[model samples]
Target: MNPAERLLEVGRYEEAERSVRESLAAYPSDAALLALLASILRARHDYPAALAAASAAVAANPRRSAGHVERAESLILLIRSREAVDAATTAVTLDPSWPGGHLVLARALVAARSLPAARDAARQGLSLAPRSVAVLLTVADVERAAGHREAALEAVQAALALDPGNAYGRWLLAMLDAERLRVRKSMRALREVARDRPAAPDIIAMTWPIRGVLSGLRRGLAVGAVAVCFLLAVGHWWWPQVDTFARYVSAVLAAVMIGFAARVLVPAGRLPWRCLRLLPRLMRSASVASLVLVIVAVGALIAFASSGWWVLAVVALGAVPVLWALGLVEMVGAGLDDPGMRPALLGLAGELREWWRTTKRELREAWTADGRRGE
Candidate 1:
């Protein structure tokens, strides 16, 4: 293996990039060096520049499968899924025996949403190189996208068994565990990944468990509110004359809910009031919206208890579903907000743009067809 490639594998991306560029200066048109540069650029999340490098590599040696494979990878990250599929197909055609070619083809098929084809390509790659960690990871990714979490977990575990220190494998396992609602298991694996790759952008996921706890609390609050309402109704029915006691109970319940919410929002010390101090840091509109809804719901609960207004109870109850939905939204937002996920998010945006472009083209074609038919 090249020293630069080893550096790239070990996550020394800047050093790898610098080494590749220096080597390229001596052999500017060398396909291998150009492909290596493309790989480094892709690792650094510079998809456009990576695409250019890969395209140069292909132009230098159109017959080389490695160049095509790198080109496909760059295209995939750029959200040009159809182009990526073509590039990967070319790579596979040029080197049918290469597991890397098959694996990347599987990834391209996945980007194109051809799950069955992706699975077939992934299986073909795995059969050719069962011990290859990259092949196994691609297979796992394909299975996960197909909603076969168990199969994905099995593949990931196998990959981890072969390469115990694979950070990507550990991260994938953690994500699969989290998807299965195995929170503790996910957290354990995530912490290991964090410890091993401290400077990795994936470390942002450390905040995920906190978000999960907050989301769970929101759901619990929703359910608990219903239970409290039921109990209040029962108490009122059992003793119609003692309305004061029910009002006092409602007020106490409201206060307790608010206190618990504050505690959950504040991660520091035992003081719930610390949440107020941190309020200014909640810059996201979504975060502010969630806080506002919680305040409104609590206020409505208090109003219902004090004035005996049934409308206030309805308003508070209605806020439950909204809060639950917001919790889910916030969870998704947290996952997408990470730097490591930026490339994937950019690809998603590209996919949407491509979809819109296709739609417009189809509309134009249909209009042209109608005009010819009328003539």
Candidate 2:
């Protein structure tokens, strides 16, 4: 095996960089060394340096797979997606069987939101290296982005089957279930994964808000119920002459209560719970109901405006929550179906959670050690 390949295998990236640099110094225009250095730089997220190294490698050997792949990756980091796509295409054309080339092409296609092509490239890479967890995950992501929820789930399941301890796969599955409005299942999945990997902050961050919202809504409902009962009792006793006004007030209060209830109930699927199977249908129903409410409000506003009932128009305007809920539900549904978009969205989320968990673990360890020293 080559020195560069050996260094990479052992995870000695800094040493590999120095070795490639020394080798390139002797040859002055060694394409392979330049490509290796570029790969190392890209791995380190030094996009500018990687781009320069990759450009040099391509200049020395335009036909080489590694050079093109490196250049394409750097271009992607630079957000020059169209150029990245062209470079990836060139790499694939020159080395159709190269796993790296296909991976780069797949990433570029995803960035461009060309879901079908991205899925194809990811699949091609996976076919060539069926055991590669990275390729499998990427394929799953592409499938999700393409609006194939079932396919994306299958890909994620396959990835988990291959590497059952993969935190990324488990986290992604949780997110998918949540989006589908399988609240209980989603929460359970998140809890299971998060417990095993307590270092993942993103899991807690995402889960906490949903949990809080659910709790808050429950509290609000209880408070509202009590308030309504008190108001009804007052009208029953001392406000008999004001019964007509009381009925109008009750109608308004009911509308407000219904709106609040829907807000709280509609988002219940986002929580982690045992009753998750009802999420998808609930999401669909909530979206439809919210939309209908918005439409009715719009018509009411228009009619009131025509009749100069500006006060009623202003009241109708308060129905914004229903519209927002409808939009959120629609978005959640759309995200669940597309496989190609899943990885970057879900993977990033998982990675962020992992990072947060790691940081917290380190901080806790440090704090404990400091306390021991103090004692």
The global C-alpha lDDT for each of the candidates, from Candidate 1 onward, is 0.77, 0.67
Backbone clashes in model 1, listed as residue pairs: none
Tell me, what's the RMSD of every candidate? 7.2, 17.4
Q: How many backbone clashes does candidate 1 have?
A: 0
Candidate 2 lDDT, tens digit per residue, 154-207? 888988999988878887887777556565566667677767776433423244
Candidate 2 Cα outliers beyond 4 Å, as residue runs? 1-19, 182-375
Candidate 1 error regions (>4 Å): 210-288, 291-310, 313-375
lDDT at position 241, candidate 1: 42
* Top of the candidates by lDDT: 1
TM-score (all chains, Cα) for each model: 0.67, 0.54
lDDT measured at residue 184 in model 1 versus the true structure, 0 to 100: 62
Per candidate, the number of residue pairs that clash is 0, 23
